[model samples]
Target: MALLDFLRQKEFAEISALKNKLALLEKDIEIFREREDRLNHDILSLRNERDKLLKYKDVSDVDNEKERIIKELKDAKEELQKEELESKDNIEKLKKEAEELLEEIENKKKQVVELDNTILLQDYGMYSPVYDFADSEMYKDRLDAIRTEQKNMILYKTAATCSTNWTLNGSEAQGRVMTNQNIKQILRCFNDECDMLISKVKFNNATAFIEKIRKSYDALNKMNSKNAVSISYEYLELKVQELQLAYEYAQKKQEEKEEQRRIREQMREEARLQKEIEEARKDIEKEQKHYMNALLKLDKQLGECDEVEKEVLLEKKSEIERHLSDLDIAIKDIDYREANKRAGYVYIISNIGSFGENVYKIGMTRRLDPMERVDELGDASVPFKFDVHAMIFSDDAPTLETALHHAFENKKVNMINGRREFFNVTLEEIEEVVKANYDKTVEFVQIPQAEQYRESQKILKSLEIS
Candidate 1:
């Protein structure tokens, strides 16, 4: 009887300790969950920043600095792998430790149940042992832990999942956010001082617990929350490289756009100045035409006038002098007006594929954003505004424009090559045309897998080497 009573007291203490540890574990799970949420948000933001940056840079240009980028990528990869291995290994260790503790707790619970059945018996008899069993709340605690165990396990699995996803994205910001959640769980799991983790531990624990309850009992019966953790880690690692590369490209593109904008402003100023010069030239031509007309009139009057006295002739000379003075003033006025009235300036993309310069683009489009459309088609980058400027050269502008169009027709518009002729332009002309007409660069989408395979087969057939 004494032995049974002593065992009950001892069991009570064990149960209390388990409860405390369980609380801590629950807290730890919550920390991880919060961290996971933070990581997800960070990952998405970084992805956006990365995507926006990509719209401006060329893959070919960035490839020149591949060596430097590769090194950075290598370092990031190693760090991520190290963290994943450590966190995962520790989780497994804790799980093993928990299993051993669970066995001990279960043994104690069985003893308490046996003691409960005897509490109704006589004093100093089986009845007294029954009272002891009922008194110790170990049985209640064991049931609670059992119910909660599944939940706790689930929470840990969830934390692992969230943590791994952030890690895989390879963004420092994302990883940091997750780490904040992880710190609390780490403390609970191994106990640490991550501020974010500390705050989230409880919330994570409850969430994980509830999720477990929602799962199928049969599925839960097969114990492997660690498997879920392991899977999450593997998936994250696979995606990290891709995400980082996307970010790098995006950053490069934004810088390119700023440069393009600066060039555009410069072009606008040049066009304005050219417009002024053209207007002045036109005014000079007009004045020259009027002066010639006045000179012809003076000659006609001199030839027709009859011979008269010297005084009369001198007066006529004075009259002609006055008219000459008036004409000079008219010319001056015309020059002044010409100086202020500016002509419209035109810029055209040029030097496309000519041998000694003076080459220009040749393409036709009804839309104003002809060059912009080329960019969407992923054709070529328009280098300068002058390069892409529109012009109407003749009374038959559309017919003469065929020279330009014939220069740039791709002959292939869609991904597949159908017998349908796309255009009648040379390759060189197309490159020039797009450069002269558009500000954005082109980037073609990847061909679908089935099409690629078919293309490969056709190539082999042509070579007779497949």
Candidate 2:
């Protein structure tokens, strides 16, 4: 029994140890579960931190993209500013060029205007005197010399040109004959054209005629171009000069004719004045003799009369003495007029019917009665009477008239002929010139009483109305 109890205790001890080992193993399992839960929590926190880091990186990338866009915009702005400045400079250059072109065009227009003015002046017969001469005679002498030179040129065969060694059929003599004939024909044609144009040249057509001559020369040369025929330059220039000389000569002749007419009129006027003075002197002498005879008769009556009759005879003798004194004064005045040949009246007159307003004729007359000359001028020569603006008696009337003419030379009615006494000027302008030239106070009739002209105008108006 004792042995059975010992074995049973040993078995019990073994079973208890087995149970203790199983308990320890359960504690270790619980520790391990706690450790695993802690580890899972740590892993989840790390994962959340990694997600935060990735979000930060995405924000940085967006900022970098924005900076890049701003840099690109800045670069584009700088380029645009540069282009703007260059465009402005180009615009300024173009504007300057346009202004310069406008200025150049204005200068060209002014030059054209000046040329037109010159051409107009030439057309008005106001040539710039190509040849200066003392008189028509001098011009004639110059023309003769020119003709002699031309004749010499023609005689020397220098007036025309042609191929000197021209040949026909290889014969030198035949070629010479042909060349001579051709030269003669060409010269004759050219000379005839120049002569026709020159003869027809006047002041108005002189430029056109010269151009025609030049054209004719060119045409003839062109027509005979193969032959190489042409007029000499010197000969052509001589012909042109002859044309100008002929025109000037014609003008000079007209001036000479007018001058001769003036001289003849002056002589006639002087003769008339002399005859009138002589007649007046004879009349004065005859009147003085009659008065003296009456005085003698009255004196004899006074010597043989009663008191009342003697008183009457004495009064009559006194009247005759007064008449003789007046006659003697008249004779002295006549003598003074006869001695002073330059003494005359300068008259300013206007014929409104024949000439328009602002037109006046200034003239001088040596007549004792200046009105007589005025009346003669207002006769059949004019449609209406001349209204006298002023009649000034001057010791040197010719000088006064000439001075007035020179003062108003540009205002003359006939610009070509200076002998024309008519002037286109206002009355005030004339008065001012008169005051400047004349030392004495000159009374001018400011308003012209064109009675005949005004009356005729009224009558014409009435006729039109009727």
Candidate 3:
């Protein structure tokens, strides 16, 4: 039984061994199954890879795809390189443009500074040098000579002989005859001498030189005579006193003549106005008589006339009454004017300096002093005073004025306005018309005394030089 147990144990051991082997085989089979599953998955992955590889199995297709990828990558690389090169070139161009603009800005800044300096230089009188002659003896002598010559010229100019010409058989003698040409020549000479003196003086001395010349001129003028030359200042003073006395006497005589003339003119005007007033009264009386006669005739016819005839007579009577009333007013005005001695004057005056030649003002004034009226007209309305061509005292001055205006209607300066009594007629033409219309020999002064205007012009010219 023990032997049987040993054998059985051996058999059991074998069985156990077999069981262990079976277990090992089962674990190996599980492992092999898992590996088979993994192998199947790997086979599927390999088959997919093989299929994908099979698509490029043709060498030319594989080469074409590979080459296309490589060419795309190469083209992208080349484009990137080109872009990088172009970016580098753009950067360089921008840097160059920036540098040029900086240079241009610097140049414009320099020009602005230069312009400022130029303007500053000009304002300070650094453009040109002023002339100086203060240290030269020759220039001083020249200035002295100029001053003496200027003084002599002033003496000659202010001398009384300069006012009128001394003629010996229609030829001018050695007096300072102030014709326009002669005056212009004298001014030219004076200006030339002044320029010579001014040129020799320093800028600082210019004002003093002008002042001295002006003072010398005034002194010479004060010592000058109207009809004769004064040899020296002291002699001139005594002669001037004598001449002044004679001038006062002459002025008194002239005033007496004017007063006598005015008296004679007043007498004539009074007589003429009285006659006009008498004539006007006679006309008024005649008109009143006619109106009364007409009214009486109308009253006699009114009772026998038809309605229309009565109206006609009434209108005619009204018109005649109106005419008579007007005549009465006229007569009253004439009587008043005659009693008041308010005779009107028709004056012919011309300002040749202010209103060129051939322009004359024909105006009337009823002032007692007609010269006052003319002087008022010449006050400030014109730049110069007017010279009287004729002053006619008339009883019916408006009628005479109207006649003269009508005579020069074609020669009116302001043709559009009849009330503008200025005419472009010569003094001689006016004289002829006046002589033909009235029995009076009118004395007309053709020359204009533009002394103030000429002197003012000379002063203005000298001021311009200063």
Best by lDDT: 2
For each candidate, the alpha-carbon lDDT, in order, equals 0.42, 0.77, 0.60
Per-candidate TM vs. native? 0.22, 0.70, 0.27
Tens-place lDDT digits, model 2, residues 1-466 = 2432453465455545545554554455455445545545554554565455446554646576555555554555455455545545655554565455455545433322111334535666545568878689988998888888988988999998895588899998998888888889988988987887677666676765665567667778778878878888898888888888888887787878989999999999999899989999999999999999888888888888999888878888888999999999999988988999988999999987899899999889998889989899889978999999999888898999899889999899988777678999988888898888794598999888989899999999999999
Residue-by-residue lDDT tens digits, candidate 3, 1-466: 2432453366456555545555554555455455545545654554565555556657664866665655554555455456555545655555565455555545433322111233334333221222233333433454455456545645575422245565545657433343434444434443443454334333233333344334333444444444323233332332323222332333344545666776786677566556656776787788788888988888899889999899998898788888878877877776667665535888998877788788999988765567877888789878888888788977777788888999999999986456568999888888898888874666666675667777887999999999
Candidate 1: tens digits of C-alpha lDDT, residues 1-466:
3543565588788877876776676566556556545545655654554455454346656654554555554555455456555555655665666676677667556434223324422222111111112322443443344435434544575323432334538687876666555533432432111122222222113222222222212232223333222223222222222222222333334445656775785566445444544564566557656656766665666677776654465566667566667656755754543444322212233322221133433333222223543333223343222234343323232344454444434443421222222443344544455446532253211222233335655988989963
Which sequence of candidate numbers ranks them by TM-score, best first? 2, 3, 1
On the 0 to 100 scale, the lDDT of residue 46 in model 3 is 49
Return the number of clashes found in candidate 2. 0
The residue ranges of model 2 lying beyond 4 angstroms of the native Cα positions read 1-122, 435-441
Off by over 4 Å in 3: 1-337, 340-342, 460-466
How many clashes (backbone N, Cα, C below 3 Å) per candidate? 29, 0, 2
Candidate 1, superposed: residue stretches over 4 Å from native? 1-286, 289-360, 363-466
Candidate 1: residue 456 lDDT (0-100): 58
Error of 1 at 200 (Å): 34
